[model samples]
Target chain A: MSAANPGATSPQTVHVPLGDRSYDISIGNGNLAEVGRWVTSLRKVTHVVLISDGNVAKYYQQPVEDAIAAEGIRVTSLGVPAGEQSKSVPTAQSLWEAALADRVDRKSTVVALGGGVVGDLAGFVAATMTRGLDFFQIPTSLLAQVDSSVGGKVGINLPSAKNIVGAFWQPKGVLIDTAVLKTLPRREYLSGLAEVIKYGVILDADFFAYLEANVQPMLNRDPAVLQKIIARSCELKAQVVAEDETETTGLRAILNYGHTFCHALETVSGYGEYLHGEAVSVGMLCASRLGEKLGVFDAESTQRQAKLLSALELPVATPKLSETAILSAMQRDKKVEHGKLRFIVPHAIGKVVLTPDVPSEMALAAWREGIEDESA
Target chain B: MSAANPGATSPQTVHVPLGDRSYDISIGNGNLAEVGRWVTSLRKVTHVVLISDGNVAKYYQQPVEDAIAAEGIRVTSLGVPAGEQSKSVPTAQSLWEAALADRVDRKSTVVALGGGVVGDLAGFVAATMTRGLDFFQIPTSLLAQVDSSVGGKVGINLPSAKNIVGAFWQPKGVLIDTAVLKTLPRREYLSGLAEVIKYGVILDADFFAYLEANVQPMLNRDPAVLQKIIARSCELKAQVVAEDETETTGLRAILNYGHTFCHALETVSGYGEYLHGEAVSVGMLCASRLGEKLGVFDAESTQRQAKLLSALELPVATPKLSETAILSAMQRDKKVEHGKLRFIVPHAIGKVVLTPDVPSEMALAAWREGIEDESA
Candidate 1:
């Protein structure tokens, strides 16, 4: 295992090696200052369509624009509301109009300058507008920097289902400035840790152990620990995305280990009630039960996850949904194929796999057991 | 050149051949009857989402659903308004919600059963829902059958831009039923012939000569003439899409020979006011003028286009857009990379080339000439 040396004088960078879609994620305090020339090109960019929500736009928008414009490239900033609800068709339409009003020509690059909601919605608009245009990501929040901004899984939500309308469009580049973490609320910052922890469990055992050892420092946003954590998590995500950009194969499903439960939790809770990472934190606890039921995980493994989530003050159990409702939501999940309830479950610490046909009776028992647990 | 034997005992099938994205356009009569069994698997398909517009659905919904259901696939039909207004986000959202209410799962397929408006919106929904699901096209109108349905160009119109929001999602297979053309309004039917003429002018000279000779029969929607026209047009579009699905290289730009003007016209006239093919017919005339100004085409070729559009009863002159307004709209065109205006102009009959750097002054002059002619 090649552990990224955050101690190296060179800043740690996670390469999102997607051939034509590939980009690099640089982590550390001063990474934001390097944005001027790190972006794809200075010559071709006639304009930069900076798409951010009102919140993040207020803080980081000026610095990001100044860095890009320092190269003599024009910048047009577009801001929308800051929330999950902002990820809608109307919002996308408004952004489309804004892009036009800004004279965002085909040569113009769209910059998603906020959190997950902004990244997904803006990337989607960039993908569809003019049948696939390029966009860059400058994710502001922990969740955005570690998860949404790196993967290129851009989409908007439909009224009936979450993320029910979108495309698998990628970004040209992603710029992660850990220094920006200073502005995130404590709860929002902790929510982002759930995904970073997920990468450790799914792909790298050592990375998982490192996260276990450094959880407190990470929460404190220590620049050294934060850079290592963000860079490794991005590398893990980028590897999974490279193996399967379209999610046609099961390799990509592993990335959704906690997502099936998380989606149902979000859907039932009303999206805004829970941050995506919080839902996943709860969903991970449920998945642990299913793994135990299937004999793939032991009690100690479940306890480790519960302890980790609890230590981080993240939700560890399903909240307020009947077993039937969870099952129904799973049926509508994008991953469900041919009427089967499929799930991405971890077999043990640092090892994940997809189970397409878990016996329904077993699944029900697992859900019942998970929801009932005091830790859950 | 593979000559399509128009008078053969069985209609000669022209394969669009888009590598991994390619599907056959069965131009023979009675293809619709075989659709249920061949395109969609009766055993695996639990439900069918049949999406059409109110106008087309009124006439063909029951029969199409009945036929698919008879093959053991459950069917749920959804209808929207027939015009370009239905291509908005609101209409797409309604249909997306309906699909969820109808319990559309991954195994289920959406069958786009109308003209370009229905096909584009439904196909866009299918592309985004669940990251992408399978869809089949049963194009009832000539424009869809000949052009939009064959290539995987599915999308919706933004209020500020036409077809500005969309994805390149291919259908599982396209079913062209020549039988449905009998009920089409005369203007709409002839409007479709413009796209047919475009394919000939852009790719196949013989196809152009054929349209010239058989104008009367085609205008009457002769089954034999219609099938030949649709097959040839699909072949041209399919070939272009196959080579350049992303449109990064110059190959796919040739498909937009007249679309630069057409999109501007659609925007200036308000999308619903002009059928896409109707705009293209006029746009083609404007493109011919640009070609002449650039010295790629002669006055004789321009006159020939004017004559053919007149014979088809299609508008040849530009609409009421002033030269400056038209130039501004053209600048907004998705095709313009950087501030330079790029155009796909016909070099001569049956040969079009995409020029990436059309001189702005010359393009403005051509726009001026077009506006003057329209006013005259």
Candidate 2:
């Protein structure tokens, strides 16, 4: 009932202003039990279709169900297998059918209580069920808390593409309990920190410096430090999302800072080869090198990110995948326009730009440079 | 190319005013050939995914593809089997895969070329594909032009429920060519008039009287009369839609004047037993009778709707089905809030109300009264 860490920072609320679709991200420590009141405070609900994955459900499902049920709201707990594979059409269909079988009505709300995959899949289910249900997110993973939960982009993947089917369905509110990250597997927890670092590099120099200063605390999952980073990440993302909720304005693309290389690496290497943030760690370096190649960024700035990511135990060296495959995937990326390579290139540690029309050779050079010298 | 009916009233436009989502419904007598210009006039497009059913594709696909191609835009024409069966998950998946295979980018538009099924299915595809697509509707059926095409309610059906998964994805523009109805199957064409008449009954006394006076012209598919009725119906529905784009406000509920009973009838009789409009015809009578039973409407008004629907050649008599099945289906209708039955009861022509807590026995009695007596 009380903060797990006596000196933990007070809970913070980041308001994402999207007019009628606007919602607050409530970041706190040891607040998972408060989900019932948290959801009811935002919207009246008679039923909740609580969706999580096996990994998350094993630990948090019962608590969330009991909490929401204590509020006299009916809870229909549905689980999918953990990992990216769960974000598929079949999983989504099963969830929708299960919810319907449980008698979900228009008045019901969908509560997503897990990492990015669960959040995206459940959010997608909420978006389409009965033409959309009121959605609340209780993000258990740091990556989801900092990134996916703040934006309204929810979707499932097709065999040919990831997130090929989806919508911009904003939740009624987001409830983030940083304490949940305590149970995250080490690699997964550290993988999430890559995005936390991304918010700093893309938009906030001061936040970047803060992450640098607290690398040790971040590695240890210190409650106070975790709360600060997660809240700031949500705030930064919420600001960008409020302005370009649907990615229509091009303003939001800046958030994809290292994603161009990251997506190619993910695609060509085959997804699940590297966790998203691990790839992002390598991708950010490639993007920075590309920025250097384009003469807009300095080598020393790239070195700073490499050092921080290395210290945090993330994959800094790009895996040795086929350069041709990477290039083709980059060309096919959503960020590309008219067969031209586009990337969010960093200009400094804190600022990034959406640069267009970069040549394939130069992008390849960026990728080739990140190849670890295994023989050396 | 000029219109087929040279004296057909000049093309009219009904502007659905929904802030930035606002779009024009272009009502013309033979503008199908002008689709390229019409689409280009609305939004710039490099590629278009033209979706239709086998029946509709045979008639309009080539012309539509050529017309859009003539505008220097690429077209990916995809078709599904005609009828309600096409509005399913498999059909939608095929469309999505085919569109992706043909290289549908975010800039690509989805143009639905057919009846209500294609509009709803394609719109649902357009809604989910790439998080959303700029959609254009070329409604080839009167049911589509006057009803489904205007509301922005697009989705496919689940085996368990019709339209259980979907979105309110507004099209960038709607192109209605009344001349296409000339090739529509006789029964399907007559079934469409049922909704046309319902629009008159629910919204405008003058419109209802216009329908009454023009029943013969309607039967003949008079271009001028078709233009007028279609435009007025679009205007009325558009006005309601603009007021309640997502059906959150109860104002949109009035648009469902006969849908509760209609859905029940369709369910108990099994889908494909009644064209949507045919079901609406019978359901509207049941609702009108229910209104009379509750003392809010008179028998004369009920008879008036029956006369118009019958004159338009739509089925008006309720079929013999299990009373328990019919009542259960009604209870399970989306219109029902909680366990209570809600009916859009008509007090007079052009004036229906969302009446709640209507006794199930009385609703059953209303259905029983509509049955034709073999002895008589």
Candidate 3:
């Protein structure tokens, strides 16, 4: 971990409550030089666009732009070009004309220093350059410190939809450090332990029996079990994006338990083939066999979530491709409704529900009982 | 004056309030076939995505997409390439890949129709496509039925900033018809009577002495004085956009009284040569001569708004241009701050204020006391 210890400790915060678009996420372990007294202690700063990602600004952008220019706060930074085709729309219209040619305005303050495509393209250039600004998120990676930096779902992506252009905006603060997952790469830290065993199989069953008893001290990267599983997956995705911040109260589609077969196996086996928590570990065994073909789960809870996602090495089967191209990419999912198919499923371990209109031959017989059938 | 009288009369509502993003504008003359029962009487929509342009989809997109597909909703519609270079970013990325190839999800319902560049590019494709949608506005001109259709602001534009990229979203309804200003073009209906005499110079001296006692029934477009000056300029811009909706309460920069010399005379007279209410009728006489060179207003109410914007034909002087290119285009506007020069001025004619740090030789001596100088 590219050390910059300004006296370590004090971090785990969380608070995303969103009334007046709330803030705070923090979390620690050498808190990357306390990102300028954690964003000028939430709010009044002069200027700081920041944004990063030429591979996390070649190991954390000069000590995070010299700890946000040692608080006089006039940073600018900028970087892009690192992956997922830099989340397009001409790289968010050339980062909104390069943050309006580096003079950003409306009391400038973007931050988003890299990972999850620099927190969804710097939280959509701070949710539209001038129409909005004050945003902050440090994220770094384990799939953006437990699911795209505690949710105010910012956007960009439309080569025919995927995050299909966005903005729920919310940030004001979100640091996360886990000492930059000690430079990740162990298959992207076991593909962010498949969304940390999908928040212990959808919302805590003793954090899914404490990740099946810290599977070998979470496969030996144990710094206090990675700060108690990334602060319990950012307090279970800031309590489902503070009770559905903008998923218009369908209680945030039970945090998309295995994101509709991990976004139709990351859109028909093609978007950097897995590594979205290894397609949420093969979309949590096709939503635990579509919760055992809707008899509300069990087949030994889909072999205890495929022996804890094959003991955290991940990919619990199901990628033999074309089940009519994974049901036409789960009928183009942001939880497709008007054309039907919706599913959050799981029932046993720490429960789940959002199962509406599911019968397409019972979700293709729960993706042909996770294949290996060979017409048997 | 294309008449399609679906039994006219009943419209005049206003509402805007904001709690739960409150809405309702209605106003009428022949309620464009009650725009699908005033947007399905507020919400349970099905699918709309209407948008529009190509010059208001050639005389109103098939009667507003056949009156919202004759109330069975599901419209789709699209269209672009009409003006302000189709509020760019490659026409909002080919309109988010043609509204996700006409299947725009998240409970689709955009509408927009036309004018104010098709309600700011279909209210910025109903605020960032799927991140927001439930919108509606039929505005068809009179500068978007009185100021960008009751202000939920939506955006796009950045060949170096102009609506830089946007969203304030808002619009569950706002029909306005005044029979589509009888197909406008009388110099865009006297440049929308200079923002309907700038909501009577900022907020209504009896709607600016009732537009100086209805100038020949508002130069004879008089369909009940163009529905009483577009319902009193959308009830004074929906009461300053419901007391400052996202222009962050400097009480919405007193609706930019002569918008800082009408955005520095629409940026040194180059943008479609002054039809933003004829550069707010010459930036409301250079903000009423910088409110009479800061002795807080009166050149007998700036020649009573220059004899009601020259009896409604507009362009009341000051366009001799280069006063250092209209003070470097009013210090690159979204109400310039950290570079000083903030404006809005006029303190009488129903008051106005926003002031802050002004001096650049008293706003260029209120732009050289509006030229026509001839050394006197």
Q: Interface RMSD for each candidate model?
A: 1.2, 0.6, 7.9
Residue pairs clashing in model 2 are none
**Superior candidate under lDDT, 1 versus 3:** 3
- What's the C-alpha lDDT at position A343 in model 1? 80
Q: Give the runs in model 1 whose Cα sits over 4 Å from its true position.
A: A1-9, A40-43, A258-279, A315-343, A356-376, B1-12, B41-44, B258-307, B315-344, B354-376
Residue-level lDDT tens digits of model 2 in A224-260: 8898888888889888988888988999999999998
Candidate 3 lDDT over B265-326, as tens digits, reads 78777888767888888878988898888899879999998988898778787857678888
Candidate No. with top DockQ:
2
Compared with the true structure, what per-residue lDDT tens digits does model 1 show for residues A1-376?
1233446324766778777667666666777777777774523665788898888988888888899889888888888998988988788888888787776655668888899889999888888876677788889899888888666678887765667677788777777887889989999999999998889878888888887787678777877787778888888888888888877666988888788888888877776799888988888877878898888888888888888888888988666667687788777777777778888888889898898897767766666666645553
Best by lDDT: 2
Between candidates 1 and 2, the lDDT winner? 2
Clashing pairs in 1: A317-A376
C-alpha displacement of B222 in model 1, angstroms?
A: 2.3
lDDT of 1 by residue, B1-376 (tens): 1133346325445566666566665665666676677555523566788898888988888878888888888888888988878899788888888888888766678889899889999999888876778888889889888877766888887776667778888776777878789989988898898888888888888888888887677777677777777877888887788787766677888877789888878877876688778889878877888889888998898888778878998887665666677778888786776678898898998899888788877876665565535436
- Fraction of the real A/B interface contacts present in each candidate? 0.80, 0.80, 0.71
Q: How well is candidate 2 docked (DockQ)?
A: 0.83
lDDT of 2 by residue, B305-359 (tens): 9998988888889998899999999988888886899999998898889999999
How would the candidate models be sorted by TM-score, starting from the highest? 2, 1, 3
Model 3 agreement with the true structure over A256-327: per-residue lDDT tens digits: 887888888888888887778888777778788888877888899789888988998887877577888888
**Residue A196, model 3: Cα distance from true site in angstroms:** 7.9
